[model samples]
Every structure is written in C-alpha cells, then in structure tokens.
Target: MSTLEPIQVGLSNALLAPERPLPPGVITWNGSDPSVRFDVYRNNVVVSLTTALAEGFPVTRALVGERFFAAMARCFIADHLPSSPILSDYGDALPDFIAAFPPAQGLSYLPDLARLERARVQAYHAADAPALTAQDLACQLANPQRLSAARLALHPACIVLVSEHAIVSLWAAHQGQGRIEDVDLRRAESALVLRDGDAVLVLPLSLEIGHFLVALAAGAPLGEAAEIAAAAGPDVDLTQAIVLLIHYGGIAAWHTPGDL
Candidate 1:
C-alpha cells in the first residue's frame, strides 16, 4: 500500500466505526485527547448521512418510527458508505438493504415503498426531455398497422414499477392524496413514475398495462407489447393505456423496426 493509503483507510474507518481507534496523527491543542474530537466528528458525519436517508425515504421512516429508522440507517451507512461525492446519489442501495434487513421483515411492503422513493429521487435528477405529444403519436401511428412494428421511446425520467403489494396506494396515502383506510393491502399495484417540469408524478397502472409498459421499456415493438398486455389479462384496456401514456408525457419518440 502507498504511504497515504493507510491514513485514508484509517480515517474512513474512524469516521464510520466509532469502535475503531483514531489514526496515528498525534497533533492536538495542548496535547488534549483525540478520541473525543474524533467521536464528535464521527457522530456528525453519521447524523448527516442518517438525515439524508430519512429525507430520501420519508414514508419508510414514517412507517417505522423515527428511532427505528435511524438505527437501520446507521447500520446501512456502516456497511455501505457513499462512494460518490454527491449526496443526492447516496442511498441508492437502501431499497435492497431494506429488503434484506432483519428489523424491516415485518414490514413486507417497505422495500417496494423504498423503491418508489428511490425512483422519485432518480426522476428528480434525471436529464430532461421534451415529452412526445398526442399529435406526435397520431402522426407516428397514422398507419395503425405500423404501430405493432414500431418501438416507442419513453421519457428519460420514466420508471415503471411492479410490486406484489398495493404500494402505489400506500405511497399516495402517505402523500395525502388517498386514504389508507380505503386501501386493500392484499391487492397488487403497478406504477408509472415520471418527471415533467419540476414535479415528479406517480400514476397507478393496471397490471396488464404495467406489463405492456415493461415490455415497451425493454424495447419491444408496440404490437408485441400490446400482445403481452393482452395475454396478461382479458381487460387490458389498450386504448386507455395508450391515452394515459400520451397524456402523461411518457413517450419521447418512436420509430418502426425498419426505420433503422
């Protein structure tokens, strides 16, 4: 290891693990104790990171009380320190962490909720794109048969999520848009997340429609996607799903397979 590697490693360890001893630097004011100073710095760093996690997963924090969330966040931080300098990019692994976390096992829907929160954060920071309009779709699909062979380009900030739990309803309840009292927890939920202007919107999707979108996002042609949606269920609502995608700025562009 290089001469400075040990110091860097030692500093990182000292900051995240309170039990680790401070690095070999002996400098202090009048030879005062270094552990106290290090402890204060370490606490501040952990607190800031924990607060960031709370901000990223407000619903999760609310689902589990603040104290419990903080404890979980601390464990997550110790195991997965930020590799990037950007704070907004931190906590990307939190959803996966929560999925396997012991304390969170009782809250089976927590991971999906965390995924929704993560999607929101990613959409907020994603590169901007002008959404394709209804006119654009009409023009592109002027020949209805051509649509089956055409691939629709989704918005740069769009994310489609499928969860076995009614996570969208749960998310909306926490955001004050819907009432938790009315939600049936056993019902599965799907969603389309997108950012238009400065706002991030999460719209619930029918299971079949959501599967269709998944296919589209995976580069499937419109015809095949529709087929997938149809096979998922008899009531796919192809028309309404198309309208919703166009209305919500989900499509950015599209082209037939032969266009390439």
Candidate 2:
C-alpha cells in the first residue's frame, strides 16, 4: 500500500494564516489568548520559512529590498511546501519558482543568483573529507598500470553552477556597500562554490573549466573528463583546474567505491 504525505494541506494553510478557520471543536488554546496562541504557530512558520528563503538567496534578497523579499518569500511559501523534514532543504525549489514568477519578469537573472546562494548553503553542510594532495596525484601517476582502475572523489562541500549571466560578478559587487555597476545581461558565466578550511569561496570558473568540473562531478573518470574539457576549450589547462580544486578542497581522493 502507498503512504500519503502526513503533512496535511489544512495544517499548512492554517499555519500560514492565523485567521484561517480550523476544523470545528479544534480550537488552539492553552488558557492564553487563543488568538495569541495561534499567532505563535503562524508566526513561527512565516519567520522560519522566510528566514530559510533569505538565507538561501541573500543575493536575491539584496537585489530587491526587505519588504519585497518578504512578499516574494510569502508567495513562494504559499505555492510550495517543504517536502523534506529538514529546514535546510526548504528553499530548494525557490530558484525555479522565481524564474517563473511573473512579477520578477524584468529580473531574469535573479533566479540564477538564487541558484548560487542555494548551492552555497548546501556546500556549507556537505560531508567533510581530506581533499587529494599534490603528492598523492604525483605518486599515483608514477604507476601507469593504476590508471584504468583508479578512481577520484569529489569533496563533500563542492557545488558547481553554470549560468549564462554574470552572476558571480553581480553577487560579489552587491555583497558589500559599494556603488553597484550596471551589468550586461547578455554576458555568460559560471562558478564553483566550495568550502575550504574555514571559508566558503565562490570562484568564477572559465567555461571549459566549468564543463570539465561538471563532468567529473557527475562521476566521469579524470582522464576522460579532461578530454571533454579540452575538447570544449583547447586551452583548459587541466593542471590548473586540479590545482584550483585541490587548493579549494573540492575533490577528496580517488578510490574504487565497491572494489574489494
């Protein structure tokens, strides 16, 4: 037998608005003002979900002011309910929602910026691992026979984003109090967000580099992944990409996952 989602639509609707009437004889009161008690639940839902959206899309929040951020967040929350029990996963669909939102029609790039932010939070919570060291790769290369069966792993906190807008430039510019410059919407860009040591760095990736990382991240072996990257951009400089990944802790180490 199939299971139904336990989070009922009525509870969701009630939590979103205190004024929404509940099922009969199910008054929410514990001797306190019933209205205030219900307000607590309603307030918690809005605040918690709104905060999640804000944290997931700081750039988007910054692009529009606080009032509009709240409005957009409320709209998002109404149309989408969190599927995961974990609060961190609450805003996963927000980027796509923003892209389709009619009011944000003029800001086509907003969704991509939200994408960057969402990836950032996920990277922050990714599993920790000791990224591959320079000496490790060098030693592995010393033994040519190890090539065919060797494997590589991506770091737990690595996230790669490929977008056609200058999202990184736009994100960096407005993160601080400076005169934000006008950007050409026609520009293309990509970025790699990863946690290195104590800091999360959002590094802009060259088109070829981004494509290469995307393939490796999808489980392609290094040699073939390098070929795809090179084919895309002849001057990809695979060594440089590896250096960046190692330096930023985006890749752990290579290993055959199921090999005995």
Candidate 3:
C-alpha cells in the first residue's frame, strides 16, 4: 500500500467512528490534541449529513420522533456513507435500511413511508420533459387500431408505488391535510408521484391504475397495459386513469409500434 493509503484509511475511520484515535501524521498545534480536533470535524460532518437526511425525510422524522430519528440517522450514516457529492441524493438506501433495522421491526409501515419520501426527492431532481396534453394524445390516437398499439412514455418525474400500508393517507395526514387519528390503518394504498410545474405531487392510486401505470412506464403498449389493469381487479377504470394521468402531466410522449 502507498503511504497516503494508510492516512486516508485512518481519516475515514476517525470520521465514521469517533471512538478511534486520530491517525498519525495529521499535523496539529503543539497545544492541541489531534484526537480532539478530529472529533470536532467528525461531529460536524455527521451533524451536517444528519440534517440533510432530516430535510429529505421530514415525514419519517416526524413518525419516529426527533430523538429516535437522530439515533437511527447516526447508525445509518455509519453503515452507508454517501458515494456522490450531491447531498440531496444521499439516503437512497434508507428505506431498505429501515426495513431491516431491528428496532424498526415493529413498524412495518416505516420502510414504505421512507420509500414514499425518497420517491418525492427523486421526482424533484428528475429531468424535465414536455407533458403530453389530452388534445395531443387524442390527435395521435385518432384511430382505434392505432391506439391499441400505442406505447406511452411517462414523464421523467413519474413514479408509481404500491404499498400494503395506508402510506398515502399517512403522508397526507402529516402534511396537515387531515388528522392522523382518522386514517384507516387496515387499508392498503398505492401512490402516483409526479412533478406538476415547480412542485412534486403525490396522489393516491387505485390498484388497477397503479398496475396500468407501472406497465406503461415499463414500455407496454396501451392495449396490453389496459389488460394488465383489468387483471388486477374488477371494474378497473382504465379511461379514468388515463384522464388522471394526462391531468397530472404523467405522460410525456407516445408513439405507435409502427413508429419505432
């Protein structure tokens, strides 16, 4: 190993684990203890990163309370260090981490809640694309035959998530739209996430609509996606879902199979 490698390792370890002594050769003033200086820097980094996480997952913090959330953040930061320079993109693995976290086992809905929050963050950072308007889609699908083979592209910011918990209701409650006491915990919920103008919108989705959107996002043709939605449950309203998708600016583009 190179001489610098050991120093790098030492610095990294010192930052992640405060109990470790400072690595040798870190220059310090004659009166200052190297360990103390390193501890100061280490605490600062952790605090900054933790604050970023709190900003990204405010609902999660609210659910777990401040003290518990801080402890959880500390453990997560140590296990999963940021790989990218963008602080906003940090905590991508938090949902999975929460899923497997021993202390959070009782809260099965916590992981899905985290996933919903992460999706919002991702939607906020997603690239912009021109939304397909109802008129535009209608013009393209003038022929029923052509409509069957049409493949629709979702907006870059669109995401569909199906959850066993009433995550959408929970999220909405915490956002001040409703009282948490009224949420039906026994009900399952799905979510459709997309950006509307400058803000990210999270809407509750029916199972059929959720399946249909997911299939379309995966490049399925219109007819096939409709079939998928119908298979999900009885009286699946594909038309209503399509209308809502257009209203939400979820569809970015569309082309018949022949166009490809």
Could you give candidate 2's per-residue lDDT for residues 71-177 as a string of tens digits?
A: 98998987886878798878889989989988898988889999899888888887887877777677666666656455567787988887888888888887763
lDDT of 3 by residue, 95-136 (tens): 999999999999899999999999999999999888988788
> How does model 1 fare in lDDT?
0.87
Question: Model 2: runs farther than 4 Å from truth?
Answer: 1-13, 17-19, 26-40, 143-151, 177-179, 255-260
- Whose lDDT is higher: candidate 1's or candidate 2's? 1
lDDT of 1 by residue, 1-260 (tens): 69889888888778887778888974688788887777888998889999999998998899898999999999999898889879999988999999999988988898999999999999899877888787766666567777778888888789999888999999999989789888787888899998867899998899999899989999999899999989987878988888887887888888886676
**Model 1: residue 198 alpha-carbon error in angstroms:** 1.8
Off by over 4 Å in 3: 1-4
For model 3, what is the alpha-carbon lDDT of residue 6?
A: 95
Q: Against the correct fold, how does model 3 do in TM-score?
A: 0.93
Q: Each candidate's lDDT (Cα)?
A: 0.87, 0.78, 0.89
State, as a TM-score between 0 and 1, how close model 2 is to the true structure. Answer: 0.82
